[model samples]
Target chain A: MRNQLRRPLATISVYGINLLHRQNPYVVAWWSAAFPGFGHYLLNQYIRATLLTIVEVIINYLTNINIAIVYSFCGEFDMAKSVVQPRWAIGYIIIYFFIIWDSYRSALVQNKLCHLAQLENERVAAVNLRPLEFQYIEPKKPWLAALYSFFFPGLGQLYNHQFALAFYAMMWWWIYLTLSRAHESVTLMMVGNFQESIAVLHPQWLLFMPSVVGGSTYYAYIMAREHNRLFRIEQRQFLAERYSHSEVRLFPR
Target chain B: MLVIGTFEHSLELEQALSLLEHDGIARKHILVILMDTDPKNPNQFLSKPTDLYPNAIEVGTAFATACAVIGTSVGFKLAWGPIFSGLSAAVGGFIVGFGLYLFVKKGIHKTRSKRLPEICVIVQCTEEQVELVTETLWKFGVLTVGRVKEPSLRA
Candidate 1:
């Protein structure tokens, strides 16, 4: 009776594990297309993602990309052209395209590498007893992970047991918040002081917001998925080791 | 004496460490250098070295100083006051110097040799224990093994 109840639970867990293992390369690429460095963040290339984000913000602001975008959207093509400095605009265009292509290529490569690593891990699990008896965490929901990051940049990392990385990200986020006066701007906007809100915001620091938010969201989701998959793998190994040769047989011949 | 060995997989490395521990080797003596093969593994995280040109900063500073001198002289020829001339020249010189530094650094980075192997195990032990350490590593099918000079303790 107990075994019968456990069978369905096992099947559900296996289905969840399969879902966690699969990461769409196109989805990663699309995240990068939406925001530079987001895809790299999803791939767990923190340093590269941070550097690319910094570059993207600096270049985007210097080239007046956001202002031009706003103007273009408002049907002011000439004003958009006028706002952008040609030399910097050219540099931004090149880098923008390069980042997209590079991120897409990297995502594809990393997906393949993850697949290889999973296979290798499975092989190791089959033969090794060391990881079998270790305590394992329950799989985390990707949406929940992303939601945590949306509230605070490093909370997701903290949830993933990356304490040091979480601290670093939290420090940076605090600095960004302070320098950008982001909270003040939001408060002002809410209170109907639109002009003051715009005045309070530092454009240079404000540019960091999209990257930080996007990167954190995507990174949290990816990390949760990867961690969940690893947990499933470890669970399988543990179960296999424990039940490979059960002494008590329930069925009689 | 110091011993270093490379391993392609973490499992083999883990096995090697356990073997060393079983042989009564001190935990302090065994150091695992996790390779940056996995982006998710943040062990020994380091920013990529982008400054490849030797003395890039000094070269940039020297160039800036030279440009400032030239600018000052040119400003004087144009009858600009010393203070205004100095300020403008300093800013212009800094911009030019920074650009030069970036250009040179990129070129040097392109030509320089790649960094060392990412994953390896480093063991610090007495001379007599070196053989045992090497044997243990060999038993676990380490990728490569070699002796290394004792690193300096001074900061």
Candidate 2:
């Protein structure tokens, strides 16, 4: 009986507008495995992702997992063993596995909901005008969205006009850039200060770059494609409503 | 006289619609029907999911990102360094993923091609205006067009 009350509207907010579309469950699971919170982010459960991400960063830092991975990779098994805090590591493991399972389960439920939403085929406002932000449905180039994220983590999100995510990603990218000393390392490498570049980098912070860059870029690319779909769906609705005139005669007068 | 044409859903088509309005066809005399794809053109997705599914680029981008993360993580052990290892993995991973996606798609579905005009516009007008209507549709690069005359009825 309450299924009628549960359908989320066009998913528009000052942050952005999104539609419930089907996402591959396995893909969502893989993203979560790559990074604890990314699967949730892809699911558009932003609040949970934000919280989980914050927890992952803090616990990972406390547990020294990144440094341990670096040490283990560098053949310093003893160093890796010595650095990790078992208590935090245990907790991190629990949370990590939970998110992966949670996301997969969520994806299944959401995928089913996606069919219902499609069946409903509710009308959406193409242009959403507000004083501080605006969102509109139009064709977006998926490659361009990927390219923007490649250049800078959050730019693709901005191009999709999903401002909340864009700003969130951009802010994190700058922090990663600053903390990793990535630019300084490149400058040094350009001049052949190889050891210095290694010395300047914080391995723990640098490690976050991979998942951050990957998750953001993938999300942006997918979102752009979705926006294009929304454009067609919207245009189709407009044409049908406006010009499929009821008065038109099937037989001549 | 009835004039009909098919078009892609694009801004140019919308412009053609407004121009038709300007050319004095009454709103009621025009009918728009969204067409299902011609069987010959099967890859283009509209109301239904197609072989490409949601996005064409997913195979390349998704795997690249996911694999790049693993490469970067494991790169700490490699002699060259994280940046080089990550880049190499992203490229290599994308190629492998793209190839696999294509292979699987090929294995599952018949070959596919580019777009076919998927919208149909039919206008009822006097014989004198048929030329004008056809010209407007043609100007928009309509994929196909046809004309028909309805028989007069006698009481």
Top model number, TM-score? 2
Runs in model 1 deviating more than 4 A are A1-22, A121-138, A190-195, B1-155
Cα lDDT tens digits, model 2, A1-253, are 1134456435556777667767878788888877789999878898888888888888989999988977876678999999999989887898899999999999989888877766666665677777988767777888799789988988999998887778888988898899887678778867876667666777888888877877778888788777766777777878888986546564856
TM-score of chain A of each: 0.72, 0.92
Give interface RMSD, every candidate, in order: 22.1, 4.2
Alpha carbon lDDT at B120, candidate 1: 63
Off by over 4 Å in 2: A1-9, A191-193, A246-253, B38-49, B53-62, B77-79, B126-155
- The sequence of per-residue lDDT tens digits that candidate 2 reaches over residues B1-155 is 88888987666677888898898988888889887654542222222335454333466667776667567656666655566677788878877887777767655554455666678888888899999999999998788899887556324
| Residue pairs with backbone overlap in model 2 | none
The CAPRI class of candidate 1 is: incorrect
Pairs that collide in candidate 1 are: none
Query: Per-residue lDDT tens digits of candidate 1, residues A68-178?
Result: 654554467897789998889887778777877877787677556555554444322222123323222455777687668766888887775555557767887887789
DockQ, candidate no. 2: 0.38
Q: Least lDDT summed over 10 consecutive residues: which range in candidate 1 chain A?
A: A6-15
